[model samples]
Target chain A: MQFHTLFSKAVPLLWYGSHVDKCEKLTRAPGGTRLCEASSIVVYKSSLLQILRLVACEVWDHLLHFVTLLTHRIIPCLDVKAGRVVKGVNFLGLRDAGDPVEIARQYDEAGADELVFLDITASHEKRDIVYDMVRKVAEQCFMPFTVGGGIRTIDDVTALVQAGAEKVSINTAAVVTPEIVRQTAQRFGRCATVVNIDPKRVPRDGFEERRAEREKQGLFAPHAVIPDGQPDDIVFEIHVHGGRTPTGIDAIAWAQYIVELGAGEIVLTSMDADGVKTGYDLVITGGVSSAIDVPVVASGGCGSPEHIRQVLTETDADAALAASIFHYGEYSIQETKQYLHEHGVPVRLTH
Target chain B: MIGIIDYGMGNLRSVQKAFESLGSQATILTTPDMIDAQVSHLVLPGVGAFGDGMTHLRDRGWIDPINDFYKSGKPMLGICLGMQLLMDSSEEDAPSRDQPIPGLGMVKGTVMLFAGDAYGPGKLKVPHMGWNSLNIQQDVSLFADAPENPHVYFVHGYYCSPADSNVIIATTDYGSPFCSSLKQDNLWATQFHPEKSQRVGLKMLENFAAC
Candidate 1:
């Protein structure tokens, strides 16, 4: 997720002092229902524009609508590998936390609105999910939780829901068989299926040699560079298995496809922004969000409260997902919410 | 005293911790002599391929000790793969591929791969991950405080279909209703991982400990 680093310095006056009319209008939908009542909306707008231009519009809209009708959400993600919580830079150098249940408890107590547990090894290991971990976490967690990683079958989704998870997130399996989405949504409710897409900017042929060198050194591949004379310069594509294989499919196209296939929500994680804490890739979030009507979760790079504020305010994302910064206690959920609230962002403050 | 029989296949530490959580001391015993000397209650935990699990048990001379433990009329709990080992034979391993390697024979069934269309052709992925509600078949001590449809964590593709359904203590459905938990006399087994299962799972351990 590529985030705008300039957002912190560009704090708007509307963020600090809320205009009563703007605040009320923000809380009320254009149709006059409560903001929360408009959780689902019909898509009436669709147009293709230059990538940079589209991103700029999204950022501007996100800022103008910062906290009006749409409320911000807090989601805690669990990266499960070998039945344990593992984290590394750009999906490499995995280190084990004590146990998934322990980590889940810590996040649950820290005021997380929802939790995501990704079975990072499910695909590579060709194994079933770690039910032991899911069962342990589900029994105690009160908030809605999503389980991802190794979900390959409808039975897997059934078992996850039965075990207590509220939703299931699919990536590799969904891409391999799109029907899985329709089948799962039909079996379980549509609201229970979340599709997570890991995407990276495909580098151009000229930069291939440089990209190969960077990849060899375990660095992120450079964004595809456009030839000096070419009109179309960069194309964003989906990356699978921790950004190792490039699908060459446009992120917006895939998002629309999955949503049509019955995905209730989409989680767009930027390979470049992931783990950097710099910010979310608003460019991608905006593009996908504009294409689909379902809730879009902006993931990957989320560093400071200001970054979150920027994404929630600027893009059409319904929620923002952060891992390292929140996991390490760099900032609290309350602080993040407070910061957003003080700014023009609408938030539900707990008494 | 509780003795966790180690055949070098499954996870025993979490089970040991679960027992300890219930305020009981459990020992992981690897040898038959150790089983003969100190074991008052026995727990056989196994993972990986079923045939490999049984081979390790037999190679370690745990076959007779486990059978003896059953004959001794002591409480014995079989978990996941260990539960499969309690059956007559398993199709998971090759040598015993078609041949039926003898099990504890306490339960009359064979461990077979789930064959059904609910998962679709090559579609229903194996290693049935996540949790499922255990449908109580017959009232058993292991489910003392467990709810009517208590969700238990499961992680295997193969399940034991006991010849006599009367012995099935609990059943769960993924594609079909299969044995989720089993109990007959002092012999008890569960296909789900209770140790890894949270509150209800711990409650199950407490029930087993009390038993």
Candidate 2:
């Protein structure tokens, strides 16, 4: 947390106004880290006032280095696509954000609890995970990092783990082959294994009940009805392939099964509220968190610090994952943490 | 040079890099014979099941040498599973058909897993992953420059309960206050990962290097 010491003596430009002799007044700022004061020589020119304003900005910039704070955590997710970070609206219309390694470094410096690198890049060829990208980030940063997106076999897990990934997330493979989660937990230990569940909220109000009656009358098909016939509070349904394909599996049930199989953590993303920047799906997040004993990271929609605070405080989820707010630089990890700290939520202050 | 013992575990490289970040020379000593005259301080860095870790140590002939290194009276530090391996025995391997896996017995303690039932329903998460503040039970030089109530990163299931309370250097509360760090003579171990704990962690490591 080094602040660049400035020793500037700029020559004043004199043209028309009368001025007295140069008078410099030195004053100390808060925390006594540095002397940030102004020399008022009673210059009449407005442009000279501009120099004073610039100096004030510089002083304020150094103020960020003075404060040391701590508490919970604010994690920013970097969905990597083709070596570049990207964000999509509801897992579609992918747009480029920044470089993965560069964004990772920024988050590390900003004091994120953990960084999750989702290798969203897909290709025709069966290539290994972005190992080189993970390796570079691991070498440069010293925070807990989790790598996910298309980790299938034990060899894939081994490669990523050896490349400095603290945890490997399983999503589609956990559904296609449930035993892989147990196998990975057996090899890398449960703490290093995670399951990312992307679920879409099912519409309530007996819609499925009506659809089931229609299907029974041969109006559509046997599998056309929703799983529970639209129960009043049927939470959410699991969706795979970037939340496009719906599996009749209940999101809460799947979370419990995955935990039973040895997933130490669960990352639940709400497809309904994702990319909308409203807030996390607290109902599902809290439901799944309370249902399982492991730490649940709430993912999907987090627009502001208040949104994060709400999920963390209102729900029993251990952590909250934000993408849009952090990606567009609306608020930094430090600012979000400050909001949480002021709101009486315990979070790590000094990075 | 700090010898980071690599008994076929994860994050061993991370520990080495952390030491290097502080301008300290740390080398990953793989074999038992490698930890000889050149090694200044010995560090055991590990992550995984206790039974599997001890098995790797025993099969690779690291058990006797690690004991010999501890006997050498040189400063030694163990992190996570490395800390658990310092106990006399561990219940983590009790379910196995073979006899219970024994530890190095450097400290009179047994490693036990945190039972999910004891903490009541949904009270505590297993693995206790993430940062936890250290309630320093006994003050030492390790946290000299670190902030008060230093929060270090941890990710593990089992914790060591030493028979002798005097050896406990610090404790962290997940559902209950458990021994998070302890020091006995030349041996010091922590259940947390100082390498990943950011600034305060870096300071603690720097203090260990100075010690």
Candidate 3:
């Protein structure tokens, strides 16, 4: 019999953390309690079996509350140049969006789970301006927001936190000095430290050709192989300095490394899909999300609420960050969350 | 005036700013001398390891003053790690599995890390970072004017299990119904950050300020 026949007759008992794909893999089960040999899924629809499933799911629900109760966070990012919110396509061509504080207040009222402010034009003299902007946002906005960009030292992290940023994200600085992440975590705790990873997909063939030429020139060893089975015949390479410079580091491996160094959260953005607003790069997002223990915020290329739902449901990402959709007033935070909640993704809906 | 204790763990400004937003003058008590008679309400705000918190309090000579303030019968509140510090001991930073580190003993309880294998194969992540609903158990002024089952922001790995159940005002289920907040006489504590919890949290702060 087809699996759809079983589905039509009986409901698959989905407890907490049970994926739909995992449920669809079920082939057969002799009884409700017994697991099928092929897919190891137990399916049952009898009244007594349904009661048992309910009781079991309830028991597991309480047991798994620590993991299951964490609602997916919807973070609206503000890429600020000096003090005003700015938008850029693929990290260039800056256009003024709005006042950072006003946009932050709107998101706060709209019940956004969190907010992110990145100083796109991170400069030395602009540090004071960022600090002032952070302080203003902190005073007006009640929710947690992370400030990133040009966070080069521990003092910068301290300044931002003191200015009311619950967490400080390190992007280029984290890539330059990995010790900064460890130091920040050690000093202020892991929850206060966030590492942002902007990864762009590179053609595997061209990358391999460059590597071979460099290796023949004795610049480096040839053993730095791209891991097997990368999706779409491409490997994600880490980019720094507002996605202007590319580092030869593997994005997934770098994520694991940063996690090891005690980054509380990882904001993974796909430069290839950013600003286009089609959808998130689920392949790399899922890749890094699965490879690490810390919460990964899948960012970039979120055009619609369905995209948000897809990334949250498909990938194990704990949060989704979008700028264009929210900044442009295409959708309110409440509407997006309503869409997510309706689509079976658990989100905190503020009335 | 509200005094927020700063032992150099986490951001105390947000808490102060939260109180300030509610038309209350709040101060970050950096030194032990700052915790004095003029301070009406005391807030012990912390985020980090239990041992580190205890060490900071002891090293900074805040242990005695904080205890004295608690004994003063004035309203006191604790947030996140501050809630854990009210306990007698904690499993975190313990010398051994059996020998837990000593807390302030202001409240009778023990803090334990969420065990990884409590729920079979898929273990839960630590630092339970996000907003979760509070299953308010007992009536308290802190939750006065707040909505039923209001969600609050929490970001911690360990949970407080007070030996005295009477002190537990609200119990949240984030895997087995751990103590989320407690109110005993003049002292109140919560495992969540009221400062970052949006409106519901601000209301709780307002109620505490009123107290």
Among the numbered candidates, top lDDT falls to 3
lDDT by residue for model 2 over A14-92, one digit each (tens)? 1111112111221211132332334633333433454566455434322311221113456778888765676631222
Q: On residues B26-132, what C-alpha lDDT tens digit does candidate 3 reach at each position?
A: 99999989877789999999887789899999999999999999899999999999999999999987878699999999999899987645655323555677887
B28-77, model 1: which lDDT tens digit per residue? 89778887656678888765566667668878888887888888888889
Q: Whole-model lDDT for model 3 versus the true structure?
A: 0.79
**Full-model lDDT for every candidate:** 0.68, 0.75, 0.79
Error of 3 at B193 (Å): 0.9
lDDT of 1 at A328: 69
Where is the poorest 10-residue window by lDDT in model 1 chain A?
A42-51
lDDT of 3 by residue, A1-351 (tens): 224322322332233343434343332323455433345444544333544554575455443533355678999888888777767322122233367877776677779898988887656777888999988888887888899988888898888877778789999888778899999888777887799999888876755665566457654323222433355567687788878786666688788888789898899999999989999988788878867767789999999999998898667688999988877678878899998876556678762
Error of model 1, residue A342, in angstroms:
30
DockQ of 3: 0.47
**Candidate 2, position A336, lDDT:** 89
Residue ranges of candidate 1 with Cα displaced over 4 Å: A1-351, B95-102, B116-118, B121-123
Residue B43 local lDDT, model 3: 96
Between candidates 2 and 3, the lDDT winner: 3
The list of candidate 2 runs beyond 4 A from truth reads: A1-71, A87-97, A124-129, A203-235, B96-100
How do the candidates rank by DockQ, highest first? Answer: 3, 2, 1
What is the Cα-based TM-score of model 1? 0.50
